[model samples]
Target: MSKKIVIIPGDGIGQEITDSAVAVLKKVSDKYNLNLEFESHPAGGTAYDLCGTPLPQTTLEAAQNADAVLFGAVGGPKWDNVEPTLRPEKAVLGLRKGLGLYANLRPIKVADALVEYSPLKEEIVKGTDVLIVRELIGGIYFGDKCESEIYEGNERAWDLENYSVPEVNRIVEFAMQAAKKRKNKVTSVDKSNVLATSRLWRRT
Candidate 1:
């Protein structure tokens, strides 16, 4: 059976890169004799300009129905001053939240051909590869009761950082497994010496 892949050619350079990715996928499909179908959808600032909403219902429905979604980057200087709730960033966040994509995997790799891309010395950057398995949905980015307040000539603001045991455990298990697959070492970074949440994270 053909696999359905939903593509969102979002904003700015998205069109350029998305086309390249699609072409590569198509070539691979033809070469391997794999059944693959692609459905392109609009999202982000472009969608907002066309449909008056950053995340259109049609796009959301398509993504929900598709087997997998290939996304392009969103947002640009044109939509920089837009309202926070209606901004292009909101569209990406909404998709992640709606789809329940909790973990964020960022692979930092230094390519031999692109050695000059690194700010570090050639010797230090050579063959330096690392995987950052971040808990995307449960950190300060998604915390509740976050707001600023000012009253009586005094200003105060607080951003809550809360997490459940299950959330932490799941992320840790994933990170450990990822580390085991590579170096068999996991270096956990946190402000455990100061923050209460970090303490809890360490304890858990």
Candidate 2:
């Protein structure tokens, strides 16, 4: 069976980037006979313009059912005045929640050729390879918040910092396993001194 890849070219330079990515994927598929298929879906500001929502129901469904998803960037000055909930960036948050994406793995490695281009000193970043595992779908992004409210005659807004035991445990366990594959060292950043949620995260 062929694997279907859903391409969500959000806005701005997303179209050009995904187009080039598809060309590369096609070449790889042909060389390996991977039987890959592609489908395009609108999202971000583009989707908001076409369907009145950054993440349309149809696009979400298609993403959930696809074998893989290739997402380009989102957001630009064009949608700066849009509502916070309906902003182009919300499409990424919606997709993360809808797809149950819980972790963002960012691998940082400095290649020999790119070491000279790095802003950091050559000796400091020459052979650096680090993986940053970030938790998603359960932080302030999904927390309850008020855009604007008057409190004590002062205009203010608040975003709740929320987390669950299961959510913390899941990401911790994933990071632990990932560490075992590398240097068996995991550094989790938390501010238990000032935040109650960080305490729970550290405990779990």
Candidate 3:
């Protein structure tokens, strides 16, 4: 069966980057004989501009039906004044919530050829290769955010951050699995000193 992928080339530089990504995807698919179908859709600020909604029903349906999604960047000053619910960033949250995607993986590898251009000392940056795993859906991004609350006679805004043990475990487990395939080292970073969620994250 051919795999269907929904590509949302969000806004600004996103369109340019996703275009290059599409070319790479098509090239790799051809070289590996991987049957694939890619469908492009507007999302984020672009979607809101065109359809008055960051995540339109048709885009949702296409994403839901696809085997995977290739998401470009989201959010820019252009949509800063938009309603909170319809913000460009909400498109990412919507997709993550709709698709039940929890963990996020980011890998960084410094090529030997580029090691000399290291911003840090060459010794400290040598052989710098790492994978950073993040738990997406259950973090501060999904928590309650508010504004116009009075605190001690001053107007204030607030945000909440939270994490469940299960959420932490899943991402950490993914990191562990990734470590097995790499150098068998996992460096988890958390600010247990300042956040309750970070404590739980560390324990997990």
Candidate 1: where is the Cα deviation over 4 Å?
A: 111-126, 145-148, 152-158
Q: How many backbone clashes does candidate 2 have?
A: 0
On TM-score, the candidate that comes out on top is 2
TM match of model 3 to true structure = 0.87
What global local distance difference test value does model 1 have?
A: 0.87
Candidate 3 or 2, higher lDDT = 2
Per-residue CA lDDT of candidate 1, range 87-183, in tens? Answer: 8877887788778787899999888999988788899999988999888777676676434588678887666788888888988999998988899
Stretches of model 3 off by over 4 angstroms after superposition? 23-33
Model 2 lDDT, residue 195, Cα = 92
Question: What is the per-residue lDDT of model 2 for residues 14-44, given as tens digits with 9 covering 90 to 100?
Answer: 9899999999999999999999999999999
lDDT of 3 at 27: 98
Ranking by lDDT: 2, 3, 1
C-alpha root-mean-square deviation, candidate 3? 2.2
Q: TM-scores across all candidates?
A: 0.85, 0.94, 0.87
TM-score of 1: 0.85
How far out, in Å, is residue 203 in model 3?
3.0
Worst 10 residues of 3 by lDDT: 127-136
